[model samples]
Structures are given as C-alpha cells and as structure tokens.
Target: MKKLRKMFVLMGTVTLMVNFCSFNILAEDGIKQVSEVQTINPRSGNVYYKYKIINGKKYKRLWSADKNAWVDPYWTLA
Candidate 1:
C-alpha cells in the first residue's frame, strides 16, 4: 500500500511538472513585442528599414534587403 501510494504521488508530480512547463511555454509564446522592430522581418526573414513617400500620397513602406524592393509598411518604431 505504501509503495502504491508513493507511485501515485510520483505520477501526480510528474503530471504537474509537465503541465507547468507547457503552460510556461504557451505563456511565453503569447508575449511577442512586435513594436521592437528589427532590421529583418520575423515572418519573412528578410532585412528591412523604415521608409515613406513624402508626396501627396504619403504612403509608408519598408525597404527589404532580401527582396530588393519596397514593401507595404507594417512595422512600428518601438
């Protein structure tokens, strides 16, 4: 009976640890700082810099190093 109880306790502890670790990983994944714009796009994995047109349109853009072209702006300075 004592051995069985110990085994159950160990199993419960292992389950709890797994749940805690998974929760922490999910929590971390939810907290991404998109405002911290890097020189590269995280999704496309391309380097970019902030750019914009100063004409009547005044449209913003990003110069992608990999694509070698201007792309629609989706980044914000943080």
Candidate 2:
C-alpha cells in the first residue's frame, strides 16, 4: 500500500511539472505572436513626419505603425 501511494505521488508530481512547462511554452509563443503583430512595416509611410491641422493650427507629427497610433505632443511651427 505504501509503494502504491508513493507511485501515485510521483505520477502527480510529474504531471504537474509537465503541465507547468507546457503552459510556459504556450505563453512564450503568445508573446512572440503579439510582438510580431505589433512590428511596424518598414515600407509604410509612417516614418516621415506629416502635417496635421488641429484647432486651426498646423502641426507636424510622426505616426507609429508599431503602436498603430499617432505620436503625441505634436511639433508646432517655430
């Protein structure tokens, strides 16, 4: 009976370890996917600063393709 109990405990520990390792691998894969999706396209037009009119004011700002958003703190005419 004692040997059977020990065997079960060993099996459970092994199962838990395997599950934890697999979960970590899956999480890493997900992180890689997210990073890849967020990467900016080199050929995209976001690299150059563009002119924008806001509140009757002309400002310049660069777009961030990686973040999929426009940069804040627009550059105003000097």
Candidate 3:
C-alpha cells in the first residue's frame, strides 16, 4: 500500500510538470505575436500596412484595417 501511494504521487508530479511546460510554450508564442502586432499601422479603408527597415530597405506587409485600428491576423486565430 505504501509503495502504491508513492507511485501515485510521482505520476501526479510528472503530469503537473508536463502541463506547466506546455502552458509556458503556448504563452511564449502568444507574447511573440503581440510584439509583432505592435509594429503594424493601418491606413484608411479596410487596408492596413506595416513597413520594416531591413538591410536599409523598407518592406511593407499587408495588415487589416478595422475602425481606424490596425490588427495583425496572426494573433486573431481562435
């Protein structure tokens, strides 16, 4: 009986650790998406744009313009 209890406790600890690690990974990806969205700017109409300075060349990427707000589609996945 004592050995069974110890085994149960060990299994519980391992399960908790696995859950925590998965949560951390998901949260990290969310943070990265938030940071990327901050650099975008939407213009008039339903069109949005974001310019990035890379190698001294400006690269523009399409974004979404909704009610004067620029939103990145990557972070909007449900």
Error of 1 at 59 (Å): 57
Question: Which 10 consecutive positions of candidate 3 have the poorest summed lDDT?
Answer: 69-78
Model 2 lDDT tens row, 6-69: 9999999999999999999898876643334476656654455668787887878776766677
Quote the positional error of residue 38 for candidate 3 in Å.
Answer: 14
In the order shown, what is each candidate's alpha-carbon RMSD?
A: 16.1, 12.4, 20.1
Worst 10 residues of 1 by lDDT: 51-60
Specify the poorest-scoring 10-residue window by lDDT in model 2. 32-41
Candidate 2: regions farther than 4 A off: 32-78
TM-score of each: 0.40, 0.40, 0.40
Off by over 4 Å in 1: 32-78
lDDT of 3 by residue, 1-78 (tens): 999999999999999999999999998876643334366664555776677776666666556555555455432212
Candidate 2 Cα deviation (angstroms), residue 75: 45
Residue pairs clashing in model 2 are: none
Highest lDDT against the true fold, candidate: 2
